[model samples]
Target: MVGAPVPALRGKPITHRIPSYKLYFEYCPHGDLHDVIKAQVDEREVPVPRVRSPGGHMRVQKVRRADGRLVPRTNRTSNVPFHEGFVWRMFEALAKCAVAMERANVLHGDLCPTNILLGEHDPDRFAIWPTPKLSDFGSSRVIDAMVASRFTPPETMQMNFVPPELGVMRGDWEVDGLKVSHRTNVWQIGLVITCMMRLEFYLPETDWRTGPSSIHPNDELHFHDPNQRELHPHSFQHANCNYSPNLLALVRQCMRYDPARRPSPRALLQRIQARIPGSCGGMDTYTGDRNGSIPWNKTEKLRGLKKDNEWPLGDDAEVVDVF
Candidate 1:
C-alpha cells in the first residue's frame, strides 16, 4: 500500500452571533493518527472478546459484525482492507511525523499502534485510495499542564504517555520529584516499536487468551532464556538496561532503564535516517526490503502509485472515507 494524500484543511473563521458575536472554526478536515489506524484496519473487536481492551474511542474498521444469532449478512460498512506491511509503513511514517512534533516542541504524549493509521491503499491513485491518517489530540497536555496534574490525577482521571514519576505518590520519592519530559516520548516510541515487532499477536486479537497482553513488561519469568526468547529478550536483566537485546539495538535505547540515557528526538531522527538512506517516495525506496515482495499488482491500482508487487495483506480490509 502507498501513502494516502495527507489529509488536512486550511483554517477558516466562522462568525457566530448569540449574546454578541464570536468566531468559531468550521468543519476542520485535519485527520488524526487514530482515524488512520481504523480505516484500513485488519482487526475487529467482539463484544464477548476475552483479552483485548475496547478500541480507541475513535471508530474502528467494520466487518460482519456479530449479534446473538451467529448468522452472516451481505451488507458492509466503509472500513477498508489493509495489508500488514502497511502497519510497518505506518510506524515509519509516525516516526517521521514525531520528528515534526519535536521540531515544534510537542511530544505526542501518546504513541501507540492505535495512534498510527493503517488505511487501505491503491497504487493507480495513491492520493485517492482511502488512506489512514494519524489522529487524536485530546490527551495532549503541554509541559505546563503536566506541572499541575503531576499532583496525582483525581480519582476519575487517567494519564497517557505519562510516566509513574509524574504522578502524586504516598511517599517522598526522588523520581517523583522529576516531571514528565521529552525523553518520556522516546520511551513511548519504544512501546510502539515493540508492538510493531509483535504485530502478529496484537493486530487481530484472535489469540488474546495466550496473547502478548498476558505478559507484563516487568514479568521476568516470561523473559527467562529458556521460557521464551521468541517473544522478547532477557536484556532487562542487564544492569542499567531493561529492554530486549535481540531486536534493533536503538529501540532498546529508546527503552533505556534510565531516562537520562535515552536519545533525544533529534538523535532518534538521525538514527532513523541512517537506517533507511533514501526511503521516501516510490517503490525505489524498497527494492530489497521485506515490503518489496508483496503481490500488489494483482489488484491494487491507485491513481499514481508506483507499480510493484509489494503489499503484504490482500484486500481483506475496506478503505473508507468515513471520519
Candidate 2:
C-alpha cells in the first residue's frame, strides 16, 4: 500500500484509476505463491536442517558451490540435509509454482521472498482463501540498476540456481540475445525458499545496533560476513507466526540463481502437490491490507533456509571478505 493511492483521493487529489486498470491481471486477494504454501502447512511442522556452502553460505549477487566452484544455487532443498519427508512441504509448493508456470510459459526471471505472498488466514483473524496466482512477473526484468546498485551493484548475471549454459554468457548479456531463461526463474525460486524458511542463504552485516538504516530489500538477497542478522522465515513474521519450511522452500526454488537450472512450472506443480497431497483448492487467501503490514511472527531479519544461531556458531575467527 506504500505506493498505492487512497480510494477517497480521486476527488481531492489528482485523477488516476485509468492507469491502474491493469490491476485485475496483477493482483488477487487469495491467489498467490503464499496461498499455495498455506494450503500445505499445519500446526505440527517437521524441523529441517539448514544447508550452506563451505564458506557459511553464498551471497545472492554472488553464488558458489559447496566445492568452491561458481555454480547455480537452484533446487532450494536439494542441497539441504533436512529436505526429506519431514518438513519440506514449502519447497514442494515452490516446485509446484514452476510446474504451474510451464502451463503459462511465463518465466519468473527474478524471484525472491517478497514476491511470494501468503494466502491462508485464520478466519478468526481474517479468512482462509486460495489465490495461487504467482504475484510478481517482469520484476526481475525491471530491476532499477540505480536502486540495485545501492545493494550489490548487480553485475554478471547470477548463476547460483540457473543452468550452466547461461553461466557461459553471464558476462555482458546486454549485447547478446542471451536473455534470462525459464531456468533462471527456477533458480531464483530456490533462493526464495531458502529465505522464506527458517533456514536462509545469507545475512547482511551493517551493525544494526549502530547504522541509520533498517532492513533493505537486498538484505533478503545478500550476505557478506559471518556477523550479521540472519534472514530466517521467523525473521519476517508479523502476526504470531511466520512461514514454515515447507512454505519457505516454495519461495526459495523461485529464487534459484540459474534460469535453466530451475524447475519448469509444471514440474514445480507436481513437486508441491506431492508434498501437500491435495488439490489447488481455495483453502487459503492473502490480500495485502491498505496498511503495509500482515499478521505473523515479528522479526527484523530475512534469512535463507538455515538456523539463526548456528551461522556464527564456530569459533573460527576467519573473516571472509565478500566485497
Candidate 3:
C-alpha cells in the first residue's frame, strides 16, 4: 500500500503524524459553509497523539484523502435544471467565500464552475442545501494591488468567465488601481450565477441543427459570457424569463464594465440576505415582508444531480487517481 512513509536522518523513522482531514478542518473553521464534513481524522482502537516535528532543513507539502464524499461538476447531468432555491444557495456559498477571502487579504484568482465543489446534505447536522465549497486555491495570491496590476492572467482561465478589463487590455486604458479588487471576484461570482440561470432555460439536444427547440451553434452552456459577444437573437428571449428580476439585476451589476461600479462581496451578501432571509445564515424575521420580495424555496429542486464527465477524483478535478 502507498502512503506517507516516516523519514529520518538517523535511528528509527520519526513520524510527525497529522490527519489529512484535521489539516483542512483547521485551515477552514467554517468548513460546513462549503459543505465540508467535520470528519475524524484518526479513529483507531488506540488513538494517536500529536507529535512535534524535529528541526529539518527541508519541508514538503503532501496531499491525502479524506472520509467525506463530494459532488464533482462532471457528475452533473443537463437533463434537469437547478431550481431557484438551490441556485440561491450556491450563490450564497460563492459570495460568502469571496467576502471571506477579501477580508483575509487573499484573492481566488481563478473562479469557475469546476473549482466549485458541491456537498450533499448532512441529515445529522441539519444542512439542507447542497452546499458549494470554493476549492483549488492554486492560483490564489495575497491581496496586493501593485502585484495584481502586473499580473498577466493565466490563459487557461475560462474565457467566458474572465472579466473584460483583465481579458482585453487596451493601450489607452486608464489605471484605476482596482483592477483585481473585490469587484473582480464579484464578476466571477456573477458569471457562475448567469450560467446557472442559463442552465434553467437549456434546450435538449436533437438531431436537427436548425429548429425552434434545437441547440443553437453558439449556445455555450458551460460558462456565462462576460464579454457579451455576438449573442444569438433568441438569447434574450429567455432574459429574466425564469430568473427573478432582482437576481437578474444583481448578476448584471456584478458584470458591469467598470470595476468601481461593482458592489463589494460583503455588500452582495447583504443584498441577498435582504432579498432572501436565511439564504446565507441571516434571520428569517423578514420572510413575510413582501413589497416585490421573492422568497427562496427551501425545498429540494435539483434533478439529474449526477456527474456528466469522468475527470480526476480530487484537487481541481485535474489529475486522475492512480491508486
Number of clashing residue pairs in every model? 27, 86, 7
Task: State the lDDT of candidate 1 residue by residue for 141-179, as single tens digits.
Answer: 555555333553521112223233332223332243445
Error of 1 at 221 (Å): 12
Per-residue CA lDDT of model 2 for 45-104, tens digit only, reads 222333666799934433577888874334322212222221233444455555545555
lDDT of each: 0.41, 0.37, 0.49
Best TM-score goes to which candidate?
A: 3
Model 3 per-residue lDDT at 223: 21
Model 1, position 72, has a per-residue lDDT of 25
CA RMSD (A), model 2: 20.0
Model 2 CA deviation exceeding 4 Å by range: 1-93, 120-133, 140-179, 199-262, 275-323
Candidate 3 segments exceeding 4 Å error? 1-79, 122-127, 151-156, 168-178, 200-241, 278-299, 306-323
- Give one digit per residue, the lDDT tens place, for model 3 in 1-323: 00101111123333447422212211111232211111111121221222345774433333233755442212212223344555666676678887888888876766766666655442322144344667677777776765467465433244445554445333322233336676778877876676565543112321121235455535533122433332233432234336566676777777666777788999998887666643423322223234322232222333223332333244656543221
How far in Å is the alpha carbon of 322 misplaced in model 3?
A: 6.5
The lDDT ranking, best first, is 3, 1, 2
Q: Give candidate 2's TM-score.
A: 0.35
What is the clash tally of candidate 2?
A: 86
Cα RMSD to native, each candidate?
14.2, 20.0, 18.9
